[model samples]
Target: MILQNKERIVIIGFGPVAASLVEGLLPAVTAGTIELIVVSSEKHLAYNRVLLAELAVGATRAEHLGMVDETRLRNAGVVLQLGRTVKRVDRSRRQVLLEDADPLSYDRLVFATGARPTIPALNGLNFDPHSEAQLPHGVLALRTLEDAMNLNKVLQGNGRVLVLGGGVLGIEAALAMAEAGHRPVLIHHGPAPLGRVVDADGGTLLIRSLRAAGVEVISEARATGIQKDETGFTGLVTQTHGIIEGAALVLSTGVRARTELASSCGLAVNRGIKTNEYLAADIEHRIFAIGDCAEVAGQAPVGLLAPGWAQAGWLAQYMLSTPAPGPADPSLHDPISLAPPSLESSDVLMLKGQGLELTAGGDIAAGLWDESGSQVTVFADPAEGKYLKMVSQAGVLTGFLAMGLPRTSAELVLSYERGSMLPADRSTLLRLDDPGILEPAGAPGPDDQLCRCSGATHGQVAHAVEAGCTTVAEVGESCRAGTGCGGCRAVIEAMLKTPVPA
Candidate 1:
């Protein structure tokens, strides 16, 4: 299919980044400057994958996970081909061949194919590379909605739910299952879960909290094979130990970027589709990539959602400036430059569930005996499942990890993000965990991030409120302050209840 006059832009993959890009380009599409066609292999609309585990445990609904306005997209004259797979890219004719559909030609093509779950090789489990192979009956990866549904069904069964991997997803899955009254055993090959981010002592505290929450953690164990009986799956055979019995298995072993299409079409493929700072896969051919599929030069695809969203927004603006794929339209206001957006910033990871509060960010590898002259403070209470470590350089908070201390962690996160100097009495920070101790009456500054998930700030929320948004839900709809993870909902509520700073 071809169109005359209008620039036809075809985007493959409809994940969060793709959805954001489509949202960003709707104005141009409505202006008749561009026509957007999105092809997605999944049947459902773009949804929040971060809440998949909660959905699996029946804690959240599918409607709550939606990330896009489908009605708005359809009304904007965007063509959405859901549950369809692209067969190949015929670059010579600038057309994409789809299975069971006519070839769709494009002036520009974007590959947002996203990433796939990494399935570990084990006995009794087989995966096909050429096709989208389904895992065996009792085994699944907690990556997609289908996998979450399967996991929910597996959780309804009697036997133990074995979770393999020690990443954030694996830990969250295990904890969720345990809370839902299912027997969950988390097996990891490392000394403990989150070894990369958490030190050995911090890992010990995390293990204690998991155990207290009724999750059986098996550390330093590698699953070598899968044991099966007349039933689908019986257990996982390990190298260090014998067979660890379980009814179903969840593989939370991370993800690999989808680069099959880019590689087949002659795009430089490394960890992902190699692109320059401008997110162009092949600028000469007008082919570009973003999200998990695009490996920007000198940097691998980050697993975080913030960077991907930033890239989508940046690329969308860039595309809007250059509607016909040549030099940027000089008449366009604020035409995007060839320079890439700055994405270098500290990443904060917060895990709160099952009576556990853990917050970690930035370089927390500082030790007690460090001669680097960085001020490092350590506090530990293993019996109570509490540990706190703060690393500061030149009195500025650099990195910190707080488990079982929510209030202190909150202060640490604010200080770290703001690059503020720590107070003279560091012991006073520990008093924040007390319920009676109230925070000073003042809201975060305009630039301070109120919602880490969406990266919404106090100024943005205030603007939304001033624009007549009275409630938390209205603020979320207006500025996306509480839309992601719902971690910032309380703060948004508090801000709405009181007058924000000017």
Candidate 2:
């Protein structure tokens, strides 16, 4: 892989992956080795799609959603082409056709066009441009910041808000609407809320949380059609029940990869644009795909910020390492792959290698266990929505489960990962006063997930810290640990404060 004097790189879709790739390639860009061109179908540059619900509720402004400033990209010598959709990609000629502009030839082309919301094809669900049925007036889908802004305008006054799907997005949207003083009703075809990710017990806990937030959750209910009156959407017709009246309907069903452009251009497509481990399409070596649009080796796409960020960095490094470099190492590691998706029921258990141990089932109930597998103590209060179970052997805390509070759980997991002996009194186990509870002197376990958002383990953090990351901010900036929810900040901060063995 040798680059000529004027090698051009064109990246399609200015979402997280593309934005991250551009940012990661800044050093090479400054050196004048590469000319980068970013093409986005959206009028705006890269923005954070993860917080669309927050934007919908007017909690954040549209400008705040953008990931990077245009001036920064311009400073890095990257060309920005916005509001122009790619018409087609001619692989044989290595060119990309834009909607209004001339064809652009590229030495390397990247397809990072993200996924789109899957609006179910129901009867009479057409968008009426002339009437109030159009978005910013009535029904809307929360995907982009523009969509959120449009929805916010229509939801000024109080009205019935029907939320379709009980997934994370749907739940978040429903909660946002309810919090905004609108009556929100959630309808899901699944048996329980967040059924795909959490078990029935966890789902029950989540449902209780939603209901406490004034959200009406109706599980095992499917929407068959949209009921619209002379004014606009009046209600939604269910498969089993009769019509449920509502002022507006929001669809959070799910999304599919936006592969119309790729498929039309004769690129191979399975569920998404099929790519190898290096995120390169099997057909064309010069072309690479990332983000939600690219499926690696038939694995279900993670479709999160962490994986996309990793993909971008690795892809940029692979592309830049040419000429003087030997064969580029195509092997890429995504820390997010280790962390469980929030929707999955995978239990983040803390196990004691010895006799005493505590296990918290998905129900948030903690159960104490002994070496003989005998249940010693069970602490659960479904009514109060609290569960704390602990297991011990030989008068020492072996295992524990503190559900609903992941920060607390993570602290306990870290304690267990370090194999620290618990205090004699079981009540003191929850207290963080003891310094010995921290990961054993300098031995940070590899399996312990340090960055909860990206599922980066303790070993990964230690490795990054050893590689010149002296501060938590540096570690976060370099590896993206405390970037998302900031839940792992305490643990990362504690590690940074603790002195390593001499």
Candidate 3:
């Protein structure tokens, strides 16, 4: 049913969100109702940015990072303009000006430019976002495949890798580097790594785990300037640690939404490209934004893939359902109005690595001395590299942070999501890590969330496995589990080995 008048959709940026969007819209694409054009500045096709750390450590290959099949996309009549940049947008003409290329007209324009690494402003480092300023030699950010390749080169040598920032990526990078037989020195200004997500007690256990994994932890140390010579980057000069020698510096500081194109085109720009609940940029023409670049309802993108994937799927369906405005009637906005589901915040944080396992969710900052009605329980054994804190409100698990206990963390996450009441005795929950201890009722049910990122439940994964999905990757392809963050991979594997009872 190829229509003569096909709605032209131009999507800029081909990341995970864009990949998901294309997958969702494949049916419509095959039906020939709409024509799709994907443009990206990166030369490579869409790949999983979540596994950059694993790639850097040589644990995963570049081919494994691909999110979409280019051949399939091309076969579906998708016009992919790779390694191309959209320099300008003409709202009146409904055309996007490209760099060294002809202007591309579109019936609907989607901004999926995602985000860029937040290069820290340090002495001896001049990174101008507006200009093409290169980072100093021996310094990098593990955000892309190119960065991973460069970082891998540095890790191959016998010098200490200075990892600045103690966020999830930073920790993963440091641990991966250490696992790959490289020296890594983790420097953070806070009392411990993951300070924003985990409390002090949990942080202490994390620091211990890092040390056990051969990563040197330098806490409360703020890096002020870069230490470099004619050869290359020597190390970093910290306010507390003074001069810390290293072969390369990996900045996992943060990320900022790439909103330059949106801002230049008179679109509302806050921390990201501003959009309404329907992912519309409030323009008369069909202009929408999603992924890490879209800031909807004053909520900025947190650099998480789950929310972006959700937006991508929703936007794809929305575009398909709504009728496009007539060519002559430019001012007539489509009457279709269905608000997208609210994006969930990163309440659940899990750090999975060798010699380290932690999961924290909700507000676990409530102290034991608090006179509040919430019951706070703390279990700490520094010698054993274990810690657990649960904040229960009226017997329901409100908040929790666990370390060195994978089983307990999994159970806690299940309970947290369910809002289920904790056992009368807290020790019973702690004993989950004990050998040969069967789950005392209230275990992971069929409906329990197995993959938080994909919203895939235990039963969903079980069904996928029963349908002949043998491996984790197969299950992921079937049910979209273990695709984001890779935190729930272990559980998915466990389920595959031991069938979940109906």
Q: Write one digit per residue (lDDT tens) for candidate 2, span 1-502.
A: 2246757888999987788899887877878988888999888888767667767777777786666768977997998999987888986666889889988888778889888777765666643321222332356678777677766765765677788887666876787677776678998888786664444554666567677777888888867788876767788888866898887788787877777777777778877888777676733356788878887766656667666776787777777774211124233323223222122212343221111122342332333332474334443456755445555555444555554433345455555545565555545544332344643323446766666455577777766776778787678667767655444677788777767656
* After superposition, candidate 1 runs with Cα above 4 Å error: 127-133, 326-339, 440-443, 499-502
* Candidate that beats the other on lDDT, 2 or 3, i.e. the better one: 3
CA RMSD (A), model 1 = 3.1
Query: Under the 3 Å rule for N, CA and C atoms, how many clashes does model 1 have?
Result: 0
C-alpha TM-scores of all predictions: 0.93, 0.74, 0.94
Q: In order, what lDDT does every prediction score?
A: 0.83, 0.66, 0.85
Give the RMSD in angstroms, all C-alphas superposed, for model 3.
2.4
TM-score of 1: 0.93
lDDT of 1 at 383: 79
Worst 10 residues of 2 by lDDT: 350-359
After superposition, the stretches of candidate 3 with alpha carbons farther than 4 Å from their true spots are 1-4, 127-133, 330-339, 498-502
Clashing residue pair totals per candidate (backbone < 3 A): 0, 14, 0
Candidate 3 local lDDT, 382-453, one digit each (tens): 888889999999999989999888788888887898788899898888888887886644667887777877
